[model samples]
Every structure is written in structure tokens, then in C-alpha cells.
Target: EGLRKAKSRLMEPLMQVDITTPEEYMGDILGDINGRRGMVGDLGERGNIKTISAQVPLANMFQYVSTLRSMSKGRANYSMKLANYDFVPPNVEEELKKGFVLETEED
Candidate 1:
């Protein structure tokens, strides 16, 4: 029964993210990610600051660092890793469908 319960893990599209920001700007960073439909995996305090780990859709990641910098007053830094592709959040999916167009290269 235990094995059966743990047998499968559904894989979804994700971008592994680690963001570090000054304590005062934590709220802004979190709020920004929330708007992007990011899933917060962890949040912890480090000395006088905070770290946030999350999985966000690649589609929502365009210019993410720049956006964060503006919100955090240039005090935030983050690292991202390509996780895996999976279903996008409904809101993100909707936005992508509505306005995100891909430009093809000419051969």
C-alpha cells in the first residue's frame, strides 16, 4: 500500500527558481511572483535577508530579472534552472494564448 501510494509522480512544466532579497523587499518579490502564478516551494530567512524558491512556468519568465530589479529597487538577485515542461497555470496559459506570439526565423 505504501509503495502504491508513492509509485508515481506526475511531471509538470516548471522552472526552478531561487531568489534572494533584502528583508524589506521580500513582500514585493513575493507579490510579483504571485501575479506570475508562481508556486512557492520554500521561503526561509538568511541572516538579515530572505530566500524564496519556486517553480514558475517558462512562459512567464521573460524579462523576469529586470522586472524583479525594478520592484526590489535593484536589491534583489536570483538564479533559475530549467526544470521540466508541464501544464501551465490557467491564467498564464490564457495570457500566452491571447498575446504571446512567437516570431519564427527565416531560413
Candidate 2:
């Protein structure tokens, strides 16, 4: 029981993200980040490039590079650094467990 409890308390990964794109693509980029459960942090620029800073859960960011590239027509560039590991949200944990059960049942 103690082992199960400890396993359930595992940490989740979080990332610090910085995305740069042309001005024309700002709206689409912002909308995409919001849809991915990301929180907008700061907005800045390096010369003509507009940059968005956000922190997003690592799980939710899978395939993000492909999606971002498609959306930007290869014009956007982004980077992420693993910022910390934190507790998984209850809902996310439940969903992950459900997925595991579903996979087992399928097999």
C-alpha cells in the first residue's frame, strides 16, 4: 500500500518555452499555446522577431515541434528547457491510469 501510494505521487515534467515567429503568425501561435494548456508568461523581441515565453507541461508538448513547424510554414523557431518536476494533477493522473488500463485490455 505504501509503495502504491508513493508511485501515485510521482512528479511530472514542466518546461520553460520560448517561441519566436514573424509578426503575422502571432495570433495563431498564441491560440495554439493556449489550447495546449500552456500559460503565457512574457512577450518580447529580438530585432524583427516576436517571441512568446510560456511554461507548459512536458506531456502536453509531445509532437509540438512538428505542429509548430506546420503552423508557421517553417518560419517559427522555439526552444524548451526542463525547468522542474512537479506533482501530476489529479485529472491527468487519472487519465494516464485509464489509458494504461485501456492498452492492457486491448492486448
lDDT of 1 by residue, 9-41 (tens): 333467899999999998888888887778899
Estimate TM-scores for all models. Answer: 0.71, 0.79
Q: What's the TM for model 2? A: 0.79
Q: What is the lDDT of residue 52 in candidate 2?
A: 100
lDDT of each: 0.79, 0.88
Model 2 lowest lDDT segment of ten: 1-10
Model 2 lDDT tens row, 18-87? 9999988899999999988788999998898999999888988999999999999999999999988888
Candidate 2, residue 41: CA error in Å?
Answer: 1.2
Model 2 has an lDDT value of: 0.88
